[model samples]
Target: MALQLIPLPPALWTSLPGRSSVRTVADVIGSTQPWRPISLTPDLTLNTLLSLLPPAAILVGIASIAREDRMRLLSVILVGGGVSVVIGLVQITSRDLYFFRITNPGYPVGVFANRNHQAALVACMLPMLGVFAGLRQGARAGAKLQAAFAAVAAIALLPFVLANGSRAGLGLAIAGLAAGLILYAGHQGAWSSLTRSRAWRLSAGAAALAGVVLVGAAALYSRNDAITRISSATTAEDQRFQFIPQMTHMTADFFPVGSGFGSFDSVFRSYEPSEALLRTYFNHAHNDALELAIEAGAFGFIVLTVLLGWWATRAAHYWRDMSRDSSARRFGRLGSVVIGILFVASLVDYPLRTPLLGCIFFVAACWMHLEPTGRTQKTD
Candidate 1:
C-alpha cells in the first residue's frame, strides 16, 4: 500500500489549485505522474519512492522469518534498549552526537535527533521486555535468563525514559505499560510467573537501581525543561496546540483536496498567523493527522481512516486471542497495542516519520498479521 500511495501524492498535488507541471531535479526517471505542477513535481515523486522503500524492505525481511523464532526477534527488540542506554550515556556525558543537546547538555538522546524520540523508543521497549519476561517462562533456565534481561533493561532504560524530560514520552510510557498489562494479563494466570518471589526481588532491585540512575541523570542534566514545556503545553504557547486549528483551517481552505504532497512547509507560510511569526521555522504540522490531511488533502485523510479501521480490527482480534491464549501468539498480538501507543504518540508528534521507527512499525504490523488467529494454531 505504501509503495503505491507514496508516489501518488505528488501527482495529486499538481492537480490542486495553483499547482503546475514543473520538472524537478528528481525527475531523472520515467515521468508518468498526474500532479505535474506546483511542488508535486517528479522530484518529490522520487523522494516518496525513496522514503517508502526502507519500510517495504523491512516488511520483506520480516516475512522471511519463521514464527518459532519469536525468541530471537523479541530478544533483538529488548537489546535495543541496552544499546540505546549505552549510546545515551555517551551522548549525555560527552555532549556529543548529531542531536546532542547544546542548550541543555545533560540529556540523553542516543542516536535520535530528539530526546522525546529517544524516550518514545525506550517507552515502547520496556513493556515489550516485560512482556517477554512474563511470557518466556516455558523453561526454568529461559525464565531466569529472560527475567534477568528484563530487570537489566528496565534498570538501564526506564530512568532515561522517565527523567529524559519528554512530557509526551512519559505519558506514552505509562500508557504503553497499561496497554501491555491489559493485553498480557488478559488470560487468567497468564502472568503467574511474573508474580513469583524472584520477580518481586528483581523488581525491588531494578527499582533501586533505576532510582539511582534517574537522580544521576537529573543531576547531570540540571535543567527541568520538561516541566516548563508541560506548563506551556497546557497553555496557548505550545507550538503543537497552536499548529492545530491553523492546520485545520489550512486543510479546509484546501478543502477535500489539499495543498500538495511535500507542500506543508512550503504552504504553511501563507497560513502562518501573526502570533506564529517567530524565528523558529515551522516545518512539520507537528500533528501527523493534520500534516497528512493538509499535504495529501482528502486522500491522506482517507488513508488514515482506512489504517485506523484496519488497526481496530487487528486489535480486536488480538484482544480476543489474548483473553484465552497464553502462547507466543498472544505475545505477537501485543504489537497491536504497542502500535496503539505509537498511534496516540503520532497524534502529538510524527514518530512514524523517523526511518527506524517506520521500519519498526511495519515489522510489528507484519508480525501481528503473521500470527495464527485461532487457539488451535499457536504459531504463525
Candidate 2:
C-alpha cells in the first residue's frame, strides 16, 4: 500500500504500461495532473489491501480458539450454508426476493453477488459434512444418528450444486464429494480388504449402480441442471476467455512491477482486445492467477508459490497422519480437502475474493493446525 503512495519520477512512471492511457485520458478530459506512478489508482490499492482484514481476523480468531470449538464453528458454518441455500431457492421465485440490490437477480445467489460464488461455498461445504458428522464425541447410537443426518444432508446438498447453475462449482462439488468419500473409506480401512470380502465387492457394485442411476436421474430432472447447461453450452466459449490473452499481455507489460492491487479494472482498458469489447466491462480477469499477475506482478507469484508450497506440504502430512481414532486429525484432513476445493475453484473463478469464502478459506487454513486433545471447552 505504501508503494502505491510513493510518487515516482516521470521516467519510471512513463515506462509503465498504463501511463500512456492515463495521460491520453487526462488530456482528453482537459485535466492537468500530477502523476503517482506506483499505482495509477492508489485508492484501489488501499481498498484491496483493506479487504484482506476480515479474512485475516477470522484466521486469528479461529487459531486462538480451543480445538473443540473448531467443530462448533464448522457446525455454525454449515447452518449458515443451509440458510443460504434456502434463501437462494427463494430467490428463484422472483427478482424482488434477492437479498441484496447489487445481485444476480433470478439466480440463486444467496448472500453473494454471484451464483457461482454461492455455489463455490456450497461445494466447499460438501466435504466438511463428513468431518462434522464423524468428529462428534458421543455414544455409538448418537454417532450413528449423526452419520445418518450427514448422509441425508449430503444427498440434499448435491442437487443444489447442480441447481445453482455453476459448471465449475459442480466440478468442485464432485471433487469434494470424492475427497470426502476417500477419507471415509480410509477411515473404514476399506482399501485393505477390498479383494478379501465378497461383501465388499457387492457393496462396490451396488454403489456404482446407484451412482449411474443418480446421474441419469439428474440429467432428466431439470433443464437448468448442471449437466444440461454444460451439455448445451455455446461452442463460442465465455467472454472471460477473450480477456485471458489480453491479460497475459498486460502481465508482461507490467512485468516485475504491476499496475497495483485492485488496478485490473483501470489498467485492463489499455490492453482489452477490440473484438472483446462489449457493453459490459470486466472487473476481474476471471482467471485469478492471471489477474493477480497483472495486479501484483512477480510479488504475487512469489507469495502464491510460498503459499502453495505450504499447502502441499501440510496436505500430504495431514493425509498421511489422519486416522479414524482421532477426530481432530480427521477434521484437519477434511479441512485440507475443503481448502483444496476453493483453491481449484480459483483457477476458473475468484471465489476467495468474496468475504464469506475468504473468511472460510482462512478458517480452514487454521483448521489444518488442529491437534488431538481430550478436553472440550467452549469458544469464547
Candidate 3:
C-alpha cells in the first residue's frame, strides 16, 4: 500500500543529519558495527536507515496531494487503521495472538512488539477516521455513507483501545477526538449557536453512545488486560524517570551538535543512571524532547520548534478563517491533534521508534497541511 511509502524521505533526512564524522570514527573502526557509508551515525546505520524510511517515503509521496487525492488518502488511513484495530481486538483475545509472541509470552501484542506501541498506532489513526466521518462534503449520500462508516468504526474500534491496556493511548484518543469535534463544529458553524437544537442533540447522542460502548466493553471483556491494569494500578516506575537528569547531561555533553542522530541507543548507555531499572541498553531517550536535546541539542530544539511553529501557524490560519474550505480546516485540525498526542505520549514512551506508528504520524501531519484545492466557503 502507498501507506507504506510516505515515511522514507524523512528517514533519509534523519539518517544524514548526524553521521559518522571524525568523532564517531573510533566507534566505527573499533566496534563491530557494520559500515553504512552514507549514514551520519554509523553505530545505528541500519536502524537509522530503517527507522527513517517510512517517514521519508511519506514526505516524498505527499507532494502531489490536493483535493483530488484528499478523500483517497483519508480512505487509506481509515481502512488501514480500522484493520489495525481489528488485529488488536483479536490479539487481546489471544496472547500468542499476533506475530510477536516471543516479546510478550503471556501478554498480547499486535504486529508491533509492544502493546503500547500498538495502541499508539491505533490512536494515531483515530483522528483521521474522525475527520473522514465528520467531513461535511456537498454530497449528502456520500456524507451519510462516511458517517455510517465512522459510527461502525467507533463502535467496533474504540473498545479495543481500552482492551489494549494503554492509558496514554486512551488519553490521546480522547484528545484527538475532541480536536476532531472542534473541526466538525467549525465546519458546521455550530459555535455561532452553541444552544442550537441540532448541536445539543448531536452532543447528547455522542455522549450516550460513548458511555454505552465503554460500559459494554468493560462488561463483556472483564478479563481484558487494560481493564485489569486500570483496576489494579499495576504500573511501576520505569527507568525513564531515573534517567532524566543523566539524559539532560547527555544533551549538555553533546551540546549544539548531538552525539549523533540515531545514536541515542548506543550513546545513552554510558550516562545511564545507577538506579536505572535496565542498564543493559536504552534504545531511546524515551522523552522525545530530551532525546532531541541529547542528540541534536540547541540546534535540534530550534529545528523542532520551527517545524512545530510552522505547523501550528498553518493550522491556526485554517481554523481562524472559517471561510476557508472545510477539508482544508480539517487537515489542519488533524495535524494539530496528532502532534499534540505524540508530544504528550512521547513524554513517557518511545512510540516514534516503532516504524508503523511513526509512519502513520507523518501521514496525519501531511493531511494537516495539505493544500486546499477548492474555493473557500463563506460563513453565513
TM-score of 1: 0.77
Query: Which scores higher on lDDT, 1 or 2?
Result: 2
Number of the top-ranking candidate, with lDDT as the measure: 2
lDDT by residue for model 2 over 233-285, one digit each (tens)?
76466766756777888988887778888888988876777877888778788
lDDT (Cα, tens digit) per residue for candidate 3, span 63-173: 666554754676776667667666666655664456753454443356777766766766666666666666656458987897777757665656667666776666665
Global CA lDDT computed for model 1: 0.64
Q: Model 3, residue 164: what's the lDDT?
A: 69
Model 3 RMSD in Å is 7.3
Ranking by lDDT: 2, 1, 3
The Cα local distance difference test for each model comes to 0.64, 0.74, 0.63
Per-residue accuracy of model 1 over 250-280 as CA lDDT, tens digit each: 8876756565566677677767888669876
Stretches of model 3 off by over 4 angstroms after superposition: 1-41, 101-108, 136-142, 187-189, 192-236, 274-280, 321-325, 372-380
Instruction: Name the 10 consecutive residues with the lowest summed lDDT in model 1.
Output: 33-42
